[model samples]
Target: MTTASTERTARTFETIGVIGLGTMGAGIAEVFARNGFTVVGVELTEEAVERGREHLAHSTGRAVSRGKMSEEQQAEILGRIGFATDLSALADADFVVEAVVESLEVKKDLFRRLDDIVRPDAILATNTSSLPVTEIATANTRPGRVVGVHFFNPAPVQNLVEIVRTVVAEPAVLADVEGLLGRVGKNPVVCGDKAGFIANTLLFGYLNHAVSMYEGRYATREDIDAAMRFGCGYPMGPLALLDLIGLDTAYEILETMYRQGRDRLHAPAPILKQMVTAGLLGRKSGRGFYTYERADSPVVVADDRTPSTDDLPELRHDIRTVGVVGTGTMAAGIVEVFAKSGYDVLYVGRSQDKVEGVRAAIARNFDKQIQRGRATEEQKTEVLGRLSGTMSLDDLARVEIVVEAIAEDLAIKTTLFENLDEICKPGTILATTTSSLPIISLATVTSRPQDVIGMHFFNPAPIMKLVEVVSTVATDDAVAETVRALCAKVGKVAVSCGDRAGFIVNALLFPYLNDAVKMLEAHYATADDIDTAMKQGCALPMGPFELLDVVGNDVSLAIQRELYLEFREPGFAPAPLLEHLVTAGYLGRKTQRGFRDYSAR
Candidate 1:
């Protein structure tokens, strides 16, 4: 199976043999058969063979039902598949791909048998996501003939396939697998022999880190997941992704990668292993981090009646004036949000001019909301009347709480906290909205560290519901609870976490984006292909590259450096490509020319 001279060329693939017949295996067979290849689908037994055939039919049937494939096309694809219970059926296969179970012994044994049965020139490929392709290749008599074609789950739908080659693999063999993938409408990205290669190599590490955060009780699973989903625009949260990946399978993948790389971040969380022991293997087994209605179901039935806050004492209402600081978009948004909630706000900033601008911006924003019928004229007037900006530190002196959304420089923020500590009353809660900076460091500036917390808000704070209420080791339980209650009062989803760099969101997010850059740097695939694969194949809101551009490479580079410094792991070490881009002034869409050239547009 191969293509040449662009998509204009007709796909030319004759006989292709797909070993194993599970979900991934069946989908692989269907992909080839759909592209007009004579697919020899092989399994261990007649029952398994029939099951594989049914799986293929069901997959194509979905495409037809979804209007992605025509009925005639589905029938034609089914006609091309020939299922057998014997390996000898693949004697004439030009290419034989093994998508068997992820066990190395089982896969190695299958490849060894195939080495004896198939032609010497026949390309050998594996769809194993976590195992070493090199180890699988070494089991064959002609190891150079073996390569990896790691496909994402539901092979017929996902477009990306990682083409892994060992040290001894022939160049021609690598070309053949890439060609075959192209013919089957897949974008092949080449990588070295590594556990979780490319996608999972980067993806699972982040997922494991998220679990560690949850296990540490830094944040609730809901808020931690929400930070990534709403803040970063990920299609699903890390815990949900772990469920989709299968908790048992995710744990196994992390353990293997951790063993190989010896990176603590890749080390499987004990809780994940414990859950697996309890027979909660995620959606496949009907439970994991979350409960599902049934196996293979995504309809979550979370016990909303369950208590949300774990150890908070009963709330006492002693309401008073609140202060909102900073003159940026976020600060203005926050002002509007608090004012809308009927809180009298003393909006403080560096200067009167800046505060005036924030007021004007808030007015313009509310005007648009009124025009869109999202707000009533009376409500807008009442909300605006609640907000008043001031430059005097004395303005915050009378307030019960203050939220600072200043610039992200450590020196400047530390100085601001020091000033707040000296001026504000003893009971005033001081909070910072710093996203990636360590909140603990900010807490260190004040004697009342417990009173100082991280009140993180998603961008355009008035609209986004998620607000991460981060508490440092010294943060008072009372203060944390008060903020949590305040968040609910203002209609925000408040998730709590510790004072670590990136907290839950950026910690899991930036690494995935960095991995994409590394993938492109290594020439595994073009930026376009990787982006397409992620968007079309995984259903992510945006591909990593696109997201990097949106977040700005400088911001991403800063977060990456932070994670790298915190973990001190070689994999977490920021990719050289990112540094180069930053140094070259390619700061994403803000400056244009990131992974792609957006200057013209």
Candidate 2:
């Protein structure tokens, strides 16, 4: 039965009809034409048609200048695309894709009109990013032949295309569309006909949460964006990406998803609507979260929100000698960072052997840097000269600041803070490198709460550039400012935020990973397809599943649980699949079995 159906619907699509001649539509037409399909591009008027023609010419002309294409090939590609202002032009087309405005009524009207003009067996598709594909299919008589073919922006360049299938869609139609997209050099992922599909569903939820963080004054816009870019390795921060996507368009997508799923995570932050109403659409309008040089320009100009150099804060306490606790990798890295920056470092460990082991680790790292030509032998000697190790906590009494990189238990950290408070001087800054634990708990444990802060550094601290500067309610502004300046002195980008669970990076990242798990738990899409949608469609460095597996399902679950407990938001709860995996001891690479088995490797 499958073979017979495949043979019957194996019709080759020769001519493709594209409705709407906007940036996305023209790019779609170019993609099909470049792949040798005859394309009929239809707009509402001749002027619109001419604009689309110019768009194609300009795009291809740039390719020629960049040596990516020849002039003759560009001409041939353009010649295959014929523009028209009437629906009758698509009468003989075998496939039709409507890339019209994101209005449901407009798309339904276009699909209804095309039903009479195209052949009876022709396949119709919508390029919607957030609307209901099943409802749009119901607008035409042959709903089984209609599907959603969503292309990411800049269709010609992006490799991802989402093929959304409604319950009534024929298997043959889906197979054909997937094969066609493959031929056009696109990586297609199939999913159910739902608002936001896969990429936008996960992507917008994160973007909305970032906006809410900004609205609540949890962090400055620059700090929030910098944390994601430097910590998570994302190509762009959420707020900046929202600006490029146009705040108005983002609001619309969020509104549609919220209306459909009723998930509070998808609800547009209140500030988004206010910005859209005030015409702060984003780069297109020269203003949104940031101001641009002009409309449609990428160059960011100075605005009232820009930080001024003249208003910089002065370092409160004169920090010369630094002290760190623990013998773990993070502790060693922190010790290396301080010593390399010309500060005398005194690190304490459980025993003399452990203290010497930290020094050996630093020597190994400096040796590797020398081999890579990133450091000099003389420089390594100078850095090592500044390091001192001891087995007694009393030695930290003379240091100006004590940064605890110890175990992540509150009892252990608070006990250490209490010891340091008694040993160290009155003005010594007591800092903790805890990522998820509350900094205030440790601050309150110390005698001088004003001197305690969080200097949370990323792993391989000698490499990663981000350091989250967290301040508790009792922490003095001078202490936070001094830590921020010290971070700069050591060549780290510092982002300040309130002392809270998950801080900045974990707060935004873990929930998205949890959502991906939920999507898999519901059998909405396979893990591989979800990963591909994010990596290709959203340009993220790694998919949520890949990151979760590397970060350990147990670790991710713990962080997610913390976030849920702190905010009490239902969406922040950890997925049951993740909990089950952790319970089964499928920790991650550490155990050789996680989201995917790696035992063979």
Candidate 3:
């Protein structure tokens, strides 16, 4: 058990009392009040009490704005809260939650006072994201009642309420808090008292890792944010989320977690510390990664505080023609994106008719755009004029780039590249849209290894914003630079990384997905429960099993093996359940059988 769980054994809080009336404080009070519990909102002064009232009012107003509540309902919820100017107001309360400044001394002193005033059975809770809950609990005679209920920002809006139980906390107190959270319509996830608890433990590591990447100049902020949002379906990217969570809060959380866990991954990026020291406290301070209009303002105003990096050298290829090698959905999409970009596209496949069928599908897509008034007939015709199909690579000799979009078979891609090397010019840029392949081996096949690079585009390339610009040691800087520039020209965000299996997205993503599978294999939870927990509990786009069905069990298994081979970590080992599914040919939506049978669909 961590400090949070330890602290819970010492404190007792009930008949809820809330000390401090900041945004978080007022939200806490409102949560308890809305659940039909009497609330005591303690503030330093009458003016501060009024401010807390305004905060509560606005929070409820937002609920009305989102159609989640009515005006009368909001008033009824507000009526239960009783505001006061003295700590003595909490004397008779059963529980007192401190939502004041994040100073450890301030919280400890407040808990010490509450310990003196409140009844023996009253529980003491802290909404501190950082700081040891144990330290606060031990400051008083009855420390067993102290618990940490870490709620995400805009507390009422976000549904997750981390019910952190300290070791000293009685089982009954923890159970009561869980029931209280459910009464307020918040899903409580129980965890031991730790710096970040469950959500922050998992979340901040990823965010801090992204910040470190930016600090190292690995990728631009825009590209980093875009990669996760577009490539991973996150509602907001890590940097943008940092801005929302506030730089100072993030730094404190990281620092606390670092001290507690001693994990380098939890260490705050130097840039984060510097930004906080500079007073760019995110949306709360009107400045962070992106500036806001004013303190506490929701509107983000543009500023030049964003970092600048040296631009990659521009790539210049000799010819203009491009050879698109494939006949699958991805191949068709790649051909369409290239053709729409006004390139002279030579879509090579085994049959001319197959190539023409893709062309016909592109035409229908263009017709749909015209029908929707998003494209003009003349523009559609112009786009179609740049596309052509061929059954042979004879016409590919004059092409500037040979993009292999064929099935992910090494032997097939090697043979095609070998043939292309014999046919194309010496300096022709060789690019592959392979999501999971070593560009080094592919580069070795050709004399112009420097020109070979990976331009891994997300599915439905035209709509997706991210393109992983991968480079091998043999790949020329100019080749990588050109691919990034081309990606930008096509309205895509490009994040460059060294050539590695899974690159960025799949490397981080597949593990989490695989872990979800393992959780199911262990019978920890049902597939539906896990999916709902991730979606409603963690705010993900889709649950793990749902994504597996869409991505296909075969593909997920292949990627897992690749990751395991590269990392050689026991944790990354492919789950036997996934292997069994693939072996059974229950490969997901395509096979119509995976975690859930989809044959009916």
Candidate 4:
């Protein structure tokens, strides 16, 4: 959004040359010509040139059909483009941009040719997603004039363009490119020559981590995608996005990044290689992670793989009355969940003050929903009427299902389970909403170990749509099934898993967040840029630092620490900066500080 600084240029780029006539290249050429610049599109052959011409026609025709453009405008845009079948056609171009295959050798060969063929003073740019810009720049004779203009897919649509600068790039050349991109209605972010520049560097690490989770069979693809789409507000699940991106493309991106960074997080999962080898290239190949109706079709159909389903327990006790312990946000959210679902909910607290606190939390939750026109006064009254406060464990004896939403410590939860074991009726399902910690250890406290299970809910349970139903080795299938079914009754997507550290989301999420902290600690990029990269570059809900602040830095550090202890993998070690921040009591929004300042709020 800043004005481009003045820079020396041989002359303003009056005519543009675009190499390659693929989807990206064609769209980019269309963008230049649509803006009234004469563009020469070069492909290797006449057939490829015709295909490129048709691509432009199809795109502009669709825009006209959709009422986004007039027929005359589309015709004028087509008239501005002149197609050729050789690189020499660009000899007169003032600026030439290469949007060819991602192979380094291919790009190097093309750039070397472009350097010799195009006007010596013409600026050269590469639309590479992850290759080092310096390497590409060095292939040209005038390296000072080379830069990276990384554009997102559908160049005619996405506004972002990463303006990459190499050490040899002259300040004047950089400014000229910046001002040109700005004139084209682009939001350019400047960054140094790096493996992924600013965007892909932060994005691919997170995407690759999700692939690793899938490789480990930790969660079903559906649930993994659902957890993020529902839990984090991501536009799509990781696996689904991988399919849309093409597994082969993703494999190549990860391979390049891993070779350059050597960070474990960038390591491509073995499964990705296998699938790519099988020709499951993704939407282009008709299949990858999920089967689509046809090649390039968006409609997805159920494949041979069976979605994991839990059968409701036939002989389980009916959970007509429920008991929820704790007075924090999670506890109150659980209380609201049960109350709104027409169950008699008994919330237990230590003192009258604690009981009042829980009630206030629930009231505040409903008040906001009501203010937003999402809840009616009668509905709020009905929900509140089902909730009853209790100061004694004796009152919980009548409830059939007792779910404890206390702090994450095992000692506190085990103690609560021990008390509940003696108070609740026999065969009562004891569930813990623990993100981490062994459910079996909590279950072993009671004689009925088979009855205890983990029902991990994302924060703000009333709004978030995911609930992980975790089963310890000792837990009965009926207990897990009952909990999973209850999640459905309360309108949540319940994902079943084994009792493991981090369950599903946290196991996959925290490590990626930890890596982001490492990047920030290493001064790879600023927090705002990293966040923007993930949100705009990867279409994520929030950047890692923003999520860390909301999730609490202490909580994230603690989770990563637990993961390290359980796995003993060097990669799981909490980043030193994150550890020091937690140790300094900068626990995030609750404390008004962490990676960002929330003090003003």
Candidate 5:
């Protein structure tokens, strides 16, 4: 299985057989037919065959309507696919792929039958994403020809296909399959017949962690989703993707992985089993983590049970004024966020020049937005007009709330909080945007400990939708609610939590990045290859190294150190390679010398 082939005979599959006609199977059939390979799709009965035919028709019709293919092309494509109620129609197929349910017994039974039906030299493949391919191959007499060709969802569009081979698999068999898939414009990667293969082993573990977090009520679903999307730039939140994947399917995948690997991370959340037992099978059942407009529609209906402040007092007092400290990019972004939300913003800087610089940076951001057609000139002017800067701390006395977005240093923030304790008026809310430092420490410095809370905003606050509202042990619940409401007023999703290092996002994210760095340090794969594996294999918006570069290795190292210091977990320890890179002043995109070269940009 580990052998690499230099000489390979080209294999041709004039007819490909696909078992099961559900969404995944039908999509696979469509892919083969569209690529000019004759596809024979088999179902249990004529009714099942009709359903498969209808699915193929609907998908191809969508392709034609989207101008991805012509009507004539669709007809020609459809002409290549034939549906059958019996498996006998696949007797002449050169290759057979099983895409049925993820049950091991069901797959073994089908492979036993296919072993007797197909030609002696024909190749048999299973599309199982989690199960051990070697075990599946054991069902057949000729295990050398059995392989796993795992295709991503919507096989026609996604370019990646993980080809899994067992120890007994002949290198020639993989060479043939690779050539065939590559000829059809698919990116083929070969790996051992391990559980979860390459992608799901990494992806499903992270997803299961998200599910476990939700099950523990660590954060609201919306906030968890927004934090990843806004903070890490994932295309979809983990819960949303799980819903799309179907909770039942995810549960099965996790179960198989946990059983094979015996790792705690692969364990499925208990809530998943409960939901599946209740028949809440995600989009297929019209309800899972979220409610959809229909069983198959992509539109998510607004949930009526969204988190609200009904428990807190009715503090509906409109926030008319806000203040932000520091002259860094986050500080300037905070000023822009408040100003754009129709609040008069007071920006406090270290000096007059720095105050002027913050105001200039805020104005230039608006100007860029206007140039990009994202905002009108009048809108930019109004937003900029709402912002005012000053060098004195007393200037924030009249503001309803003062959000401290200064350096991540604890001493600097504690000193600022002490000043705010003296300078601000009574009943004013003081919030800190410290990423890792304890909010309680800052609260202790203030005379009004109940008033200080953590309101952490991601980079470029105006664009990111997530705002974590942290409440210290002494902080008032009403103050936390008020801060949450203020986040809503500014069009942000606020997740409430007790003060802790890394909060929710960084706590979960940095460990994964550190794992990737460890993988690189071990030479398991090159940085570029690991990044590609994550991007294409797991569907992340950016690979770990890519994100590390943009996030600044120096910043990541600090966060990792804080998490390690607080948790004292060996897993949270910063990678030596990461620390070395930071020590070398390779501070990511800022220095243009992180994992990947960005100086060219």
Candidate 6:
């Protein structure tokens, strides 16, 4: 191994060299130049060099147009970067980052050539997202000075940058690179050299699973995309994101990760290879999972796969009164939703006190809404007037629908369904708000299985707008339509899917969270570092660990276990570390501890 000096002093980097002038490379060069460093951008051919130059100008010009940077400043920034068609121009570069293609051999060849051109003290880095940095580093004589600086796309805007350190990397070299990234306004997350590192490893697995869902016709693409956006507050859906990232690029990354880790979850879905082969390469090609308006267009145009309103099942318009069971937060919110939407809501609890608690909860929520100018005193009174509380299931006999938001325990919920079946009228729609339990299992316990459906709602339902309308095999077409229409009437976005372990959101969510746990358990990276990688690197609303802590470790483990049982995929199994956390009674915020400590708060 080529070792660098073990000195602890910080190194000053003035000249930065970037090889390849593709989109990523150009963005990286702009980042360095904007940070006031002299940038030497090298490309193989003059045509490629001009493309890189135009990319920089267009990006900086947009900043000027947006008033983010003055034209004079943009010119100054452009002036700081100098382009060259030869590696000899980088002889004096203090730091060099290779942002070429994903091919290992090509990167190794570039590094070997750089060994003869650049100074021995200059730090070398690869911007490879999936290829092993260590193997690429080994091609050079000074392997100890080589590192991986994986920047997110649109590097000028994205804040997170992963600093991958191999076992042979010198400590000083790593520190200097991290310091340089920090100086350039990037959040640097350091981790051991591993394929996919942090973000892509967790992200692609979830994306691939979504592809598998789409391939199986588990749900319509629009519903699948809307579920994640509305249910989890994700900025974009998996399929849409896959389109933004070229399908071919995503496939190659998954393949590389799978080859290195041998983890089945990282294996690319078969459809991904097929899609790439068909030239359906997402936005660039105008088609992938969704058809774009044209090549390189962000606007999507309707195709044959788009659902038509003319074919929708007829909705039952007779749902005037709704019944909600349980006194929990979800039950109270559901009752509030129904009441506020002009439906008479009858809520049942274990006793009169618990039943009254539901009413009080709704009253408090309405008061807050009124305070926020979202409702009026008369509106609150009118909504409260529409709500009725009772301790007897027999009172639901006159209701048009009954939504069970009780405990997630299978036996407890099944027994409730059996009782609701006996008490409710013949045409009453019975819905369960179970997030993970099989809706079919609950349906089978009732005589009116055709009336049974899953109406899974996110927590704090009064604020959240998503309600997953899951239909079992036995669910009548009209019943699903009626519930879906009811959701629209109540101002909720309902995404339909077949009854399964997790429906859509949880099915796609928890596995990624479990993967984060596995990543932590393996000592690959710290929880905070992993969280930062996701939140900043991938533009996620929250990191997997932060979400897991908020969701409760026990709840997450239960959902993960259900997924494992239903799919029988080894990758679906709950991570042992998560199980241990749950076993220790570190449930979540309620218990004051989980993946993180809440007691301090």
Against the true structure, whose lDDT is highest?
A: 2
| Residue-level error in angstroms, candidate 3, position 127 | 2.8
Candidate 1 Cα lDDT to native: 0.84
Candidate 6 deviation (Cα RMSD): 2.8
lDDT of 3 by residue, 1-601 (tens): 5454543343333468888889889888878777778888999998999999999999989988999999998988899888898888888987678899998999888888776678788777899877888888889788777888877667766787777777798788888887777778887767667677655655677678678767876666777777888898898888888988889888989999999978666789899999999998888888777777899887876567543455443546544777888877778888778777778888887887788888888888888888999988898788778887888887788788888888898888888888888888778888898888788888899888898889898988777878898899888877787887777666777888878778877876787677668657866446775675567645779878999999999999999999889878666799899999999999988877889997676
Q: Look at candidate 4 and tell me the lDDT of residue 65.
A: 97
Model 6, 1-601: lDDT tens digits are 8899866778999999999889999999999999999999999999999999999999999999999999999999999999999999999999999999888999999999999999989999999999999999999999999999999989999999999999999988999999999999999999888899999999999999999999999998999999999999999999999999999999999999999999998889999999999999999999999999899999998899998878654467498899999899999989988888999999899988898888888888878888999889999889889988888899999999999999989999989998998998898999999998888998998888999999998999988989999999999988999989889888999999998888999999999999999999999999999999999988899998889989889889889999999999998889999999999999888899998888988
Q: Each candidate's TM vs. the true structure?
A: 0.86, 0.97, 0.77, 0.92, 0.85, 0.97
**At residue 416, what lDDT does model 4 achieve?**
93
Give the per-residue lDDT digits (tens) of candidate 1, residues 332-424.
988888888999998887877898998889889878888998888888788778888888877788888999988989999999999899988
- On lDDT, who's better, 1 or 4? 4
Q: State residue 110's C-alpha deviation in candidate 5, in Å.
A: 4.4
Error of 2 at 406 (Å): 1.3
Residue 176, candidate 6: how far off, in angstroms?
1.0
Model 5 Cα lDDT, one tens digit per residue, 265-351:
677889999999998888888889988888967788867756544543334444789989889999998888888889999989888
Selected candidate, larger lDDT, 1 vs 2: 2
Clashes of each: 1, 0, 34, 0, 0, 0
TM-score quality measure for candidate 4: 0.92
Local distance difference test, candidate 3: 0.81
The worst-scoring run of ten residues by lDDT in candidate 6 lies at 308-317
- Model 6 has an lDDT value of 0.93
lDDT of 4: 0.86
User: Candidate 2 or 6, higher lDDT?
Assistant: 2
Off by over 4 Å in 1: 1-11, 61-74, 115-121, 138-145, 167-180, 291-321, 367-382, 422-426, 438-448, 514-538, 561-584, 593-597
